[model samples]
Target: MPRTDKASRLIAAPPARVYAAFVDPDELLAWLPPGDMTGRFDHFDARTGGSYRLTLTYPDAGTGKTTTDSDVVEARFVEVVPGVRVVQAVDFVSDDPAYAGTMIMTWAVAAAESGTRVEIRADNVPDGISAEDHAVGLASSLANLAAHVEN
Candidate 1:
C-alpha cells in the first residue's frame, strides 16, 4: 500500500514571499534540505510542465538513496499556481526497487491571521523511507523554510 506524509508551519511572512521561496531555486537551496543535508540543483525551471533535478548530500556516509552520501531527485512541476500552490511529481534516482516510484508532493500556502500557513503533503511515498523519519524530515524542512522567509 502507498503512504502519505504531511507537515505544516506558520511563517511570519506574506503568502507571496512564502510562495516565492518554494519556486525560487536559491531559496529552495537554502531551506529544502532537512537536518544535516545540503542541496544543490542541477537544473531548475519553475512552471507548469517544467522540471528540476536536485541532489541532496547527507552528512553521514552510506545513508543516501542514490550514492553513498547523496540522494538525487528528479521532479516535474505538475501544477503551479502563484501564491497558492505548487504540485510536483518526484522520483528518486536510485537503483533500489524500494525507492523506485513517483511521489506527488503538493505545497500549499494560504493567508492566515498572523502570517502565511504553509503545508506540504507528500503522497505515494516510497516504502524505503520510514514514516517517523519522513515526519522528522518534513518538520525539519518546514522549520528551515520558516527561518529562511521570516528573516
Candidate 2:
C-alpha cells in the first residue's frame, strides 16, 4: 500500500527565507538529520531535472560510536515555485535489504497572519516504509529548521 505523511508548522520567517532553506546544501546540512548523521552534496543544483546525492551514516545511538558509510542516493527536482512550493522525487541506491526505492516529497509555504505555514508531505512510499517514520522525520526536520532560523 502507498503511504503518505504530512506535517506542518508555523514559522516566524517569511516564505522566501523558508524556501531558500531547502535550496542551499550548507543550510540543509545544518538542519537535516538523523542528527548525528552527516551528509556531503555530490550535487546541489536546485532546479527541475537537477539531481543530488548524499552519504548518510547510521551510528550507534547509545555509544555515539561512529560508523562511516554512504548511500549512493539520487533526487530529481519535480517542481519549484519560489517562496511557495518545492517538490522532488528521491530514492536510495543500495543493495542492502533495509534500503528501498524512490518516494515523492512535497514542501509548501503559505503566507499566514503571523508567518509562513510550512507543510511537508511525503507520498508514494514503497512498501515497508511506514507513515509514522516519515511523520517523525518530517517533524524533526521542521523542528531543526525552526531552531536554525530562530537561533
Candidate 3:
C-alpha cells in the first residue's frame, strides 16, 4: 500500500511572497532543503508541464538515495496556480525498488489573519522513506520557508 505524509506551517508573509518563494529557483534553493541538507538544482523550469532536477546533499556521508551523500530528485510541475497552489510529480533517482515510483507533492497556500498558511501533502511516498523522518523533514522545510520569507 502507498502512504501519504503532510505538514503545515503559518508563515509571517503574504500569500504572493510565500508563493513566489516556491517557484523562484534561488528562493527554492534557500528553503527547500530540510535540516542540514543543502540543495542545488541541475535545471529549473517552473511552469506547468515543466521540470526540475535537484540534488540534495546530506551533512553526513553514506545516507543518500542516489549516491553516498546525496539524493537526486527528478520532478515535474503538474500544476502551478499563482498564490494558491503548486503540485509536483516527483521521483527519486535510485536503483532501490523501495524508492522507485512517482510521488505527488502538493503545496498549497492560503490567506490567514497573521500571514499565509502553507500546507504540503505528499502522496504515494516511497517505502524507503520512514514516515516519522518524512514528517520531520517536511516540518523542517516549512520552518526554513517561514524563515526565508518572514524576514
**31, model 3: CA deviation in Å?**
0.5
What lDDT score goes with residue 94 in model 1?
98
Candidate 3 whole-model C-alpha lDDT, 0 to 1: 0.96
The models' CA-based lDDT, in order, is 0.96, 0.74, 0.96
Q: Write the per-residue lDDT of candidate 3 for residues 1-151, one digit (tens) a residue.
A: 6999999999999999999999999999999999999999999999999999999999999989999999999999999998899999999999989999999999999999999999999999999999999999999999999999997
Off by over 4 Å in 3: none
Over 14-125, each residue of candidate 2 has an lDDT whose tens digit, in order, gives: 7788888888889888877645566678778888778787655554433211223544467889997777888989787755444465778898989888778999888877
| lDDT tens readout by residue for model 1, 43-147 | 999999999999999989899999999999999999999989999999999999999899999999999999999999999999999999999999999999999
| C-alpha RMSD in Å of predicted model 3 compared with the true structure | 0.6
- For residue 93, model 3's alpha carbon misses the true position, in angstroms, by 0.2
Clash pairs (backbone) in predicted model 3: none
- TM-score of candidate 1 against the unseen true structure: 0.98
